[model samples]
Target: MKNAELVVIPSPGVGHLISTVEISKLLLNRDHRLSITVLIMKLPIDSGVDGYINSLSATATPRLRFVDLHLPQGDSASQPQDPSSKSKSPLSFFANFMDRHKAPVRNVVAELTRSDSSSRLAGFIIDMFCTAMIDVANEFGVPTYAFFTSGAAFLGLKLHLQSLSDDHHQDITELKNTETELRIPSFTNPVPVRVLPSVVADKAGGSTMVITHARRLRETKGIMVNTFMELESYAVEYFLNSDKTPPIFPVGPILNLSDGGDDIRTKQSRPIMEWLDHQPPSSVVFLCFGSMGCFEEDQVKEIAQALENSGHRFLWSLRRPPSKEKNKMQLPSDYENPSEVLPEGFLERTTEVGKVIGWAPQVAVLSHPATGGFVSHCGWNSTLESVWCGVPMATWPLYAEQQMNAFEMVTELEIAVEIKMDYFKGFHGDEDKKPEILSADLIEGGIRRLMMGGESEIRKKVKEMREKSRVAMAEGGSSYNTIGRLIEEVMNSIA
Candidate 1:
């Protein structure tokens, strides 16, 4: 069992890929006896994952390695095209890719097994989206685990949904159609169905996909979550005691030690870093969305108007939606001159107080001493990064599970202030053409509260959570021991 190897196949997105890679790193570090090989597929547009992977591999132990896997493409004409939208929906495309590529990926796996007899396949751990690969593991008579990207609360809720699938009760489909709150475990307050991720709230038949995915998770060897036991004691407890659940590993708050590792951050960080140096400690609020944090033209204008009104020191990383060819979740490049769409003279007027950059070196910016608060889209990864940096947030969830994440941060954790709580992107219809629901006044108020300490009383809370995250990853901490427990379980099973 010492050299037993695990195969990891991640979904084709930067968030999933990076988190999964981090898990691989933690696993290898925890047990020198373990080995891992990651199978990857490419995103149509680059979001720096390739470069990150290269750097990781260069420094990675010999026990850990990666290989690229290709998926066959289906007809483009058959794809769903949301006209008037700059970013095309990637859901169907990925779903189709999974279906078409499953066979070939299995063939590759079978061949890899034949060639590497010494490093026997111990098991498979895959992104929730790559559930199809479970079949390949089953075919090879191996166990499979699900690497869920979100927190334990989300998983507890998903397990609840799975149990609701029996007779006399409805499945996720019926739950989506209802107007009641869901009684999910691990969270104190009842969650409004609308605030739940689209899988349970999507009116567009998308919940059906989520339901299917949740069902698939039930069949895994276990589901690994990126949260620590301390941060989610309620959740870890709930799942562990729940019936019909697999082993739950709260193996994170897995901190990324340094950011600004890629060439992109290095090239773009000079100006942003310089500006941060001039500011007072913990004074500036940095506004950035995750890779996909683009706004409609009017929304951008509203944000500009709000910043001018707030009169707070700020650095806004404004982004436009990429053309159909790019990764929607990427940080966007800003206007060399932002005055192009700004209320005229907005740049010069706020010159002393605010700076706008296309791609503000996020990790660098967030980690800087001057950044105190974040106006964010509340992507889970970005949320974790902010917590790790000890910065508080004003949450603005746009799409996907962002709304749910926003809710968790604000209501559940009380670590963030809510900007526009009930907002849903698809509800506006013709997504890109959707009107801005958040007025300048509302945005301004949220910023003021976060920066000035109103109900956005996040300064003390975030600092405490940040320290918890650090301790949790340190020796003898909850996360560190969680990894050890997981390694022992895997070893015992194979032994």
Candidate 2:
């Protein structure tokens, strides 16, 4: 019989859901006395996490339960409003969407408590975006712990900025256009304003919502960051040293390396693997942006030219941009004919040296022996995956906290190559404004340096971090010990 029960609430996106599930599995595997119930919140549009959820349910233990919250009919939470409206930001939309689920979530918690006599409801583990659910946890008189799907450095940045705004009463919106550098405690170097997350840097967008979430983090029982101390020693140490922040646990490098199942491997990913099988080991440069990353025709052509000119074997996952129709969800679609966006005759010319495909098997590709260098969007999950697989990256951050992630890896960690530190493809309606295009020459230079730099220090560092990542997840590692401490605290809360 389970002794203690934990309810986990995760945000809708696949990246967030994947990390949340991995962490939950880690906790369940570590302590037999613990049971977890994950509350699923569906996205306004189909983000394709349902298949993954179903697979998990098929293999899940009795102690692990998934409860899907019922959405009210005609409830439009994540739908985009008028651009001129104050609630136009996507961050605000997501925050509001999660806020609407408070009633259902509270009811679910009440039911769990009522149904189980043997199991005690220990706490609520909430996703970073689900901070509003803390209110539900409070109503039940249980502590809430935040599962930060991002790295410790980004977590520290959020807390520090929130403190500056709330405690110091400073107007952080003024920092959007300023060229000044701010010295953050987690970072070794002065951080430039341009490298800030677009949500925080954009004055008219989601800065308020972002700051609100950071403020709520301080109220949590403890914050669990999805990064290992060995990888982010300084940031982890910074949180440990600061008394103002709640107890911080760096229990990660938490990754979902599974490519669904064998059927997916044989059907969807066979071609990609077959191609990689032929390439010389560590000869191909793999370029794949995250799920939401895509570009226009102009940017697409520049990248094609760069790959062709670089004269290196390459595997590129190029996606078509989402529909421009008003009130439509902005998700990347697969191109019917990629040549329409590429330079004329480009595919035929480079067919021998490269392959351009849509919807890559990212984890499988990263783990492949042939994938030497990665040209990535630097999403936190992608960053951790690259490190876990020992692949060096050339960073090209498109949105969210990715620019800051790129800055940390390149400038702070010195493990990744820089493609463009401050590349911001604006979120929500901001994409309408034409962002500066990266030229082919600059792209080619980054690719060449990443691929042909020849046993460089960056490569060596990534290899070393890969080993450290393995050690952290092993028995008696830092992340293992941190998880143990977290479980102990939850058990103690029962007394």
Candidate 3:
């Protein structure tokens, strides 16, 4: 059991934590000699997120252990005002937390390697946000792998764009003065500039985050991404042949389908799942944004109106936007009660056709036989889960690199239908005036196209990709070989 013990540290976010845990599971699933211990960063507040991680860790077999690394916490002023909200910005605040605590993590690694002789240090597999841990692995002469929890196209685009930032005189992560589209090697189509992540859109603080990631990822031994080769072969092949990139591995579609967590079921998931169980096969479109995704009151009403007009079966998870006092970062607004916000008689009129919950069990909902399409914010995890479940999507990205993910899914991959790709960009941070919201007509059109209209080809394409998603993780498949190769490389270094 002590022969090949690997250590992984994940950033504090639940999404990152979940992906890292799944990756650790993949690494030790079939390898009896391998064991893993995950060092989780302790956040400042009692958000229940840490408790969720603890619960999942408890369920992991004896080979996997999760421990909290007593690292320094962020200043109270810097942390989110809402203790329980999952909408913390991954790039800025979390990055600062990791940067501040780097020395503690390094010291921990050094101590483990120095004291533990029976168990060999396989390497440090860290969240991309937690890239500081890589230096510790290097200092102790052990390998480190960056665990990218997004799609490979995005990873390839990141590397390609980073190279451009380095070689070009201008900051490529920032939108150039006249730039309308970005031409990345990983993507065949030129992506519209308006849809890039906040890293590209905001050139000040966000630029530092993007540029820093570009620089740090190159320094790791290799990268392990949460995608399979079949879904991202075009980008994977590009990375493999490029002299610029380190070795790349596609060891995912690392999915966590369970609906349980720390004894909290989000209160609304039960009725939603029960409602789904009674629906006809492949008849419902499930709409959910990630923890961070939400819309203003008008936007929520517009979405409700659109759902009313689409005439298709639907399940929409709504969470109210953090109240102004609680919206510390002034992030976007989320909806809570669909019926309360809907036009009078609207909820009753659509009651038979659609079900709206304040929160839904996303993975379980997506995997259900009744769900045929997903209306997503395109957070990488949500995108992968939809694909892994073989559900097609209607893309409606709200923030961060989600627009980039939406662009990849709709244009680069043809698996999703785009509704309002760049609708709110101009108004996102603008304080003077109200932004033009996406209207019901447009949302209705997108839902119609995605669920029952002319987008049969997209449905078919997603179906095919879903099959490949499964195949890639099977024995002798692309992901299997990639993970095997990655582990072999790590084991060889220690021997």
Candidate 4:
């Protein structure tokens, strides 16, 4: 048996973990003798996400193990309160966790180095957020590859925007003051500041995450992002040709590897999928804002009223009100009751057209023939999933780099169209009121455009892109070849 081992580090989030598992599987599927160890803290029982990790452990044929690096139990009270939720400030708690835990992770690296298999530690694959892993890899003289769970367009913009930050005198919002265009090398469209990831454009110096990211970009030995070449060929080409850029490998549609098929079949994802099945094809518009995003109760009501008014079939994932207390937050008294919150006689009238639920099987819904369009927050995973499903997007980017992703989808690649935007400036924190929300009228127009009328042009382009995505994963496609080469390279490095 070949004695080679690879350690994969993933940030502690559902999206990051899921993508890492897919790459782990790709490695094992190709090399039977490759021993793999995944470094994660612990699985949360509440979310039922543990199954994904266990599933990989069960199928990795040769040898695979999880090396859990956990936080001290007594420190639970001190555990950062996911500053993301607590602070609306531009700072990211995700980066803070990394900064605080670097020492413990380094200790884990030392423990691995002392093992009998230390000599066999041939490679390290780490999420972009876990930049500290590069130092660990250097400690043992192992080559490291930075694994980006997002698409190429967002990644390209991130790198490009970082460079722009060096020279531009003003912040992202100020850049938006004049309708100035953001000129990135790979993309043809000049995106506005309002369309970039919120974090990058913020002038607040508290968040050093982007600084770390820029540094890692220049240091990593190789770069790997979870996207196929066909879906992001332009961005991929630019990265490859850049001076001093690490070797770029586009390997993904990673979620599609799930044997459960495109639908969310697990108990957690089932209820959502079941509801989607009852809706008619090409008629129901699916809207999901990912796990972390939240909107005010009134915004939710407005969206509900708009969908009802448009007379379009729809499925919405609504978050429960923040606090049920009378004073803390006020929801439409009828909000909990579907009949009261929906248009008068709306439920009965649109019974054939709409379904409202707390959550829905997103992938299955998108892949379904009935789901003609997605109104989304434009997260990288959602964007890629929509592309894989031949579904066109009605982009409504909420926060983070999502706006950047939405801009690329609409303006750069022309696979989707943005809902009309109203920007808010001088907002100190996310907890404050949003500057603008896409009203029902804008949402209705977006749905109509993407579903029919002049929007058919975008739909046709997406369908063709979907074919390209399929081919890239098939027998002789670019992504297929890249995966094969990556496995071979890892194995050869060991020998």
Best by lDDT: 2
Task: Give stretches of model 2 more than 4 Å off.
Answer: 78-87, 261-266, 427-429
Query: Scored by CA lDDT, what does every candidate get?
Result: 0.77, 0.88, 0.76, 0.68
By the TM-score metric, which is better: model 2 or model 3?
Answer: 2
Roughly what TM-score does model 3 have, to 2 decimal places?
Answer: 0.90
lDDT (tens digit, per residue) of candidate 4 on 368-445: 787888888787888888998989998876656677777778877889877753232121213335456658887778
Off by over 4 Å in 3: 45-48, 72-92, 173-179, 266-268, 327-338, 424-435, 453-455
* Per-prediction TM-score: 0.91, 0.96, 0.90, 0.85
Q: Give the least accurate 10-residue stretch of model 2, judged by summed lDDT.
A: 78-87
Give the per-residue lDDT digits (tens) of candidate 2, residues 19-40.
Answer: 9999999999988989999998
Residue lDDT tens for model 3, 19-59? 78888888887677777888877665444456676677556
Which is superior by lDDT, 2 or 4?
A: 2
Candidate 2 has which clashing residue pairs, if any? none
RMSD of each: 3.3, 1.8, 3.6, 4.5
What does the lDDT come to for candidate 2?
A: 0.88
Report the number of the highest-TM-score candidate: 2
